[model samples]
Target: MHKIIVTGLTGFVGTNLKKYLSSYEIESLSVRYIPNQKIEINADAIIHLAGKAHDLKKVSRPNDYYEANFELTKQIFDSFLKSKATVFIFMSTVKAVADKVDGILTEDTVPNPKTHYGIAKQQAEEYVLGRKLPEGKRVYILRPCMIHGPENKGNLNLLYQLVAKGLPWPLAAFQNKRSFLSIENLCFLIKNLIENKMVVSGVYNCADDEVLSTNELVQIISLALKRKSRSIAVPKSIISTIAKIGDIIRFPLNSETIQKLTENYEVSNKKIKTALEIEKLPHTAQYGLERTIKSFINK
Candidate 1:
C-alpha cells in the first residue's frame, strides 16, 4: 500500500480525503508557521492541504495569510524537493486566480487576485510551479472552487439554515450560475492522481460537470428537507437598497453577501476531466447538493 503524508489532516477537505483513501496508510504532519523550518517528509506521496483559508469576515491580518499560506507552503515544498516523495499535490483555490470570473474560468486564465488570501495562495502556486523537479517526482496544483460537503459551515450552511426555517429565497430576481466541487469527486480525482501515472503534472481546475443557479440550489435544499421552496422575485433595485442599509449596520444581508449570492462564477473542469480520462464527474450537481443538505438536516 502507498503510504501518504498529509498536511491539514484536521480540516474539512483533509478529513474527507483521508477517509476516502481507506486502503492507504495516511500520516498527518503537524506544521508550524516558522519560516525556513526543516520539514520531515517520509512517504511515497504528499498531499499538502494546509493553508490559511479565505476569511469572509475580513478580520484577519495581511501577514497571517503570508505566514500560513505562502511561507509555510514554501517551507514544506523545499523539504519535498529533497525528500524521496514522488508525488506532491497542492490544494490551491480558484480565488488564487480571480475573485470574480467574467467568463467560465479556465486553467489558462491570467491570475489577478485582489485579496490578501488569494495573493498568498498565488505566491505559493508560483513557488511550486517555478521549481525544477527530479526525474521521478511529479507535482500537481489543483484549483478547486466552492467545495461543499458534509460538515461544511460555509455560505451553503447559511442557505441551508434559511431553507430549514421555511424562509422564502428573496433574490430570485438575479440569475447567476456558479460552479461547485463535491467532496466525493474531489477525493476521486486525488486518488486517480496518486494511482494514475498517465495524468500529466500541471495546474488543473476542479469542478463538477454542471453549473447551477442559486435559485436552483434553493430548490435542492428544499427538496432535501422535504419542504416546498418559496422563491420571491424581489426587484433588484429594492434588494440593493436593503443591502446598502445592511452594510451600515453589519447585517446578514450586506453588500458582500449579496454579491456572493448573485455572482456568475462558473469554472471549467474540462482540463481535469480530460486528464483523468473521465466523461462525467462521480456526482451530479443536484445529487451532490442533496447529499450535502441531507447531512446538514441529519445533524
Candidate 2:
C-alpha cells in the first residue's frame, strides 16, 4: 500500500478524503504556521490541505492568510523538495485565480485575485511552480471551486436549512450558474494523481461537469426534504436594496451573501478529466448533490 501523508485531517475535505482513500496507508500530520520551521515527510505522497480557508465573516487579518496559506505552504513544499516524497499535491482554491469568473474558468485564465486570501494562495502556487523539481518528483496544484460534501457547513448548508424550514427562496429573480466540486470527485482526482505516473504535473481546475443555478440547488434541497420547492421572483433591485440594509443591520442577507447566492462562477474541469482519462467524473452533478442533500437531511 502506498503510504500518504495528509494535512488538515480534521477539516471537512480532509475528513472526507481520509475516508475516501481508506485503502491507502494514511497518516495525519497536524501543521501550523511556524516561521522557518522544518517539516519532515516520510510518505510516498503528501496532500497539503492545511491552509486558511476564505473567511466570509471578514474577521480574519490579512497577515493570517499570508502566514497560513503562503508561508506554511512554502515551508512544507521546501521539505518535499528534499524529502523522498515523490508526489506533492497542494489544495489551492479557484479564488487564487479570480474572485469572479467572467466566463467558464479554465487553466489558461490569468490570475487576478483581489482578496488577501486569494492573493496568499496565489503566492503559494507561484512559489511551488517557481522551484525546479528534483528528478522523479511530481507536483500538482489543484484549484477546486466551492467544494461540498457531507458535514460541510458552507453556503450550501445554509440554503439547505432555509429549504428544510419550508421558507421560500426569495432570490429566484437572479439567474446565475455556479460550478461546484464534490469531495468524492476531488478525492478521486487526487488518488489518480498519486497512483498514475502518466498524469502530468501542473495546475488543474476541479469542478463538476454541470453548472447549477441557485434555484436548482433549492430544488435539490427540497427534494431531499420531500417538500415542495417554493421560490419568489423578488425583483433584483428590491433584493439589492434589502441586502444593503442587511449590510447595515448585520442580518443574514448581506451584500456579500447576496452576490455569493447569485453569481455566475463557472469552472471547467476539462483539464482534470482529460488527465484522469475519463470523459466524465464518476458522479454526476445531480447524483453528487442529491447525496450531499441527503446527508444534510439525515443529520
Give one digit per residue, the lDDT tens place, for model 1 in 1-299: 28999999999999999999999999999896895578999999999999889987789999999999999999998999999899999999999999999989999999999999999999999999999988978899999999988888688977888889989999999999999999999999999999988888899999988999999999999989999999999999999999999989968898988999899999999999999889998898777788888889888
1-299: candidate 2 lDDT, tens digit per residue: 28999999888888888998989899999999987788999999999999998887789999999999999999999999999999999999999999988979999999999999999999999999999999999999999998877777687877987898889999999899999988888888988888888888899999998999999989988988899999999999899999999989968888988998999999999998888899988887777788888887777
- TM of each candidate vs. truth: 0.98, 0.97
Per-candidate Cα lDDT values, in order, are 0.92, 0.91
lDDT of 2: 0.91
Q: Any runs in candidate 1 off by more than 4 Å, and if so which?
A: none
The C-alpha RMSD in Å for every predicted model, in order, reads 0.9, 1.2
Q: Could you tell me the TM-score of candidate 1?
A: 0.98
